[model samples]
Each structure stands twice: as structure tokens, then as C-alpha cells.
Target: MSPHSSNDGGFAKAAGAPAPQTIVTDAEGLDAALVTLPGGAPAYVARPGEGDTYPIVLIAQEIFGLHEHIRDIARRFAKLGYLAIAPDYIIGYGDPRTAPDIDAIRAIVVRVPDAETMTIFDEALAFAATKGGDPSRAAVTGFCWGGRIAWLYAAHNPRLRACIPWYGRLDGARTKAQSRWPIDIATALKVPTLALYGGADPSIPLELVEAMRTRLKEAHAPAEFIVYDGAPHAFFADYRESYREEAAKDAWARALAFLRARGAG
Candidate 1:
């Protein structure tokens, strides 16, 4: 692992503990087991070992790829009576964990086709369905880069009950790998999506955020964006200096409520 510090130029793993609200599981009944997606893709599954079938929460990884953080998020969902799965969807492109820097990760990301990601997640959903997860009670939530995918997934899967996109860009320059940006699909959403964003995120201008809001409102789409004033991007990442404790707390509360209200908890 890269020796990271808060002042690093780009992505840095949390150096030590005291992670804002780290939850440790004894791996008791709440165990996270390795699983394979329909196509043999790698995934980590977490659920209450003693309970009945649970709602499914499909977790999309950060730009950093599926790491301990994403797995922990799955474990957290298990505690909430939901079976969560975090798949290493980017494996076909490249592993973000080995990138050494954010720019390198972006290089891999820029070349990853959205269609491929959509299909992988679809297979992942199929895998979750077999693990006793209720497909009708399914939801999706992702962070940063994955947040953008959350929006796309909401549009792709008509069965998603709810979705939350965290600080994902509302608009961006398109590439061959990425034919459409989130803004392009605002009017195409079939499910309710709650987008949580940071007001001061340098990468995402407020105007784009407003534009996305306006488009969604005009389309009468069931999507909403919550901008936390003064918070930077990736505020929910407790291990990073960009984390905003107050904003993260409020975001989680709102997400839990949205999930529960949609029968996805």
C-alpha cells in the first residue's frame, strides 16, 4: 500500500485508524464471503447468516476500485438487514488498487466502456438473486466514479427501487468508452434516484449541478440532488482528508431513510 498522507497530490489510502465511523465486524454471523458473478467476475458478499432472505444493495466501487472500503460498506448494509454485494467490475479494465495514483486510475477508467460495466452489474444482480437476495427490493448506491454509474444503473435497470449517487459528476466530456454522461440520461431514469453531492467540489461545478437538477425537474424524473455546502468531493470517505463528517452523517441518514421507504432496507 502507498504510504498516504492527507496532503498527497492525489488518491491516498487512509494511513491509520480513527476512521470517522469505522465499523468492525467479528465476521461472526455477519460474514463477508467471496463469491463469483455469473461470468466468473470476483465479488464479496455480506449478509446476516441467521436471518431470512434480505433486500439487496448493489454497491459500486469508488474510482479506487473495490477495496476494503467498499467491502466494509457491504458489511454495514448486512447489519441493516440487507444483503450487499460489491463486485470488482473494473477488473476487466485494470485494478485501481495497483494504479499507484489517481491519474493512472483515470487512465483505466477512461478506457472502460459503460456498456461493459452495465452488463457486469447485471450479472452481479443475477448472482445476488441466487444468494437469497430479494430482487424486487433492490437498490444501488455508489461513490465518486461509481456514483456516476449509480445514475446510469438507475436508468439501465427498471427494477431498481431506489438509488443514491454520491458526488458523481452531472456532466463530463464524452469518450468512445463512455458514450453518454449522467446528464444525457436525466430524462431516462425509471427509478427514484437521490444524488448526494458536495457544494465545493472543484471537479463538479455548481452550474452543472443546477443544470442537472433543472433537467430532472423538467423531465419530472424521480431524482434529487443534495448539495452539502462547503463539502468537497468524496465527503463520505472517512479515510480521506476530503471527508466531511457533518455532511457524511446527514447523507447516511437520508440514504437509510430513502432505502427503507422504498422497501430496500
Candidate 2:
């Protein structure tokens, strides 16, 4: 099935909704805008300084595509001195921001295939290389749905130095399109991965998380999974109700250390 395109119409926040925060300010040196991914998907890219090669970090979005929250994330990474690129993996599908509710967002997400999303990620990596990024030192990080992709990408691309998957589902009912779960690919991973999850997330059961840990142990995969005591899914998304500041801050610190230790800095 062909992917759906986002319809511009929807209930956008009122003008009074809090103004979005800016995370980076190298105005003269930074380049910020949409760049085309392979297969024509559009991705937002942000860089810290001109002519300086920096480690690349692909910031995968939640089901929301490259919305303001995701954009802010890219800027935050840029401020940290990495070239961060966030692609609209769902460009072929409808926009999650336009969805009236969660069901509509899920409908769009389910149509996006793992293979297709990986291709877009590859494109984002290529785009980063052209903008002064060290391709050999690339890393990826994501939230929620993007988190699962981060794990799969580590297995898919051997050049990746590290991966950080935040609050992603570890196991789920299989579908024809999603042939392998993160646990299924753990043994084949070429890079180290750190998975941060919420202990109380209903969407991802604690049992499944334990199963993933067991599989990783048996395979001796270079992976680590941490569960925050009372956090819920999307705890890192400061814009939503699920945001848990304490857990999110801790996870972010761990993620940075994980990536840098793997030579992504």
C-alpha cells in the first residue's frame, strides 16, 4: 500500500498556546531547514558551526513526524555540538499533528514499514554528511516509535557507532511488515545500544522488557536496558502529559554518555 500524505487542515493550537522555545543560537553559522531524504521524504537538519566536522545524530521523531517538539530536539542536539537531523519518516503518510486523536495517529503509524523508515534514515545520514558531519561517527536516538527504529537501525547499518532508544516498545504482536522485533535482532547488532524505558508504561509491558533482557543476555549483545521506577511512556517529551522531568533528565544524561563513549562525540 502506498503511504498517505499529510492533509494541512486540522485543529492547530491556538495562537495563545505557549510559544515554542528555541534551543540553539548560532544564527550566523547554523543551517536550519528541510532537506530531501532519499525517496523524496523531507527531513529537518540543524548544525552548530560552519566548516567544522561534527558527529552526526539522527533524531527520530515520535509518531508526530518533524513537528515543533522534534524540531526543538534537533536544535537541542545542535547546541550540544552535533549535527542533528530529524526526518519525516511519515511524509508519505498523513501528518500526526493533523490527526484529531490517537486512533488516527496509530492508523498512520501502522502503515509505515520498517524498511521504508530505514531508507529515510539513510537519507538523513547522507544529508548530514554533506553538511560537515563525520559519517563514520554517526549515532541515532529516538523517542517512542522512533526508539524502536533506533534499535533496528543499529542492526541495519554497520557504520553506526551507537544507538539510544528511549521508551520504545520492546515486544509486540508480529505483523507481516514488521518482520523482526528489537529482541529478535539483538544478536546481530553491530553497535552498542542503550534502551531507556518506563516501568509503568502500559503499551510496553514489564514482562516483555524482561524477555528482551533475557534475549540480550543469551546473545551477549552489547546492549543495556534501564527502567525508570515510576515513569510512563514518552517521559522525555516535555510537551506532553506523559513527560517525567526527573526520569527524562537522567535518561538524557545517560544517552549522551553512551553515545560519546561509543565514539560518536
Q: Give the top-scoring candidate (TM-score).
A: 1
> Residue 224: error of model 2 in Å?
0.5
lDDT value for model 1: 0.81
lDDT of each: 0.81, 0.79
Model 1: residues >4 Å from true position, as ranges?
A: 1-26
- Tens-place lDDT digits, model 1, residues 1-265: 1111121122233223346564344445574676678776787788877666889999988888777677767777887888888877787888787676777888888888898888888987888888788999999999988999989888999789999999987778888889888899998887988899999999998999999999999999998888999999989887666878899999999999999987788
| Residue lDDT tens for model 2, 95-137 | 7876767778888888888898888898889878987899999
Q: What lDDT does candidate 1 reach at residue 145? A: 89
List all candidate RMSDs to the true structure: 5.2, 5.3
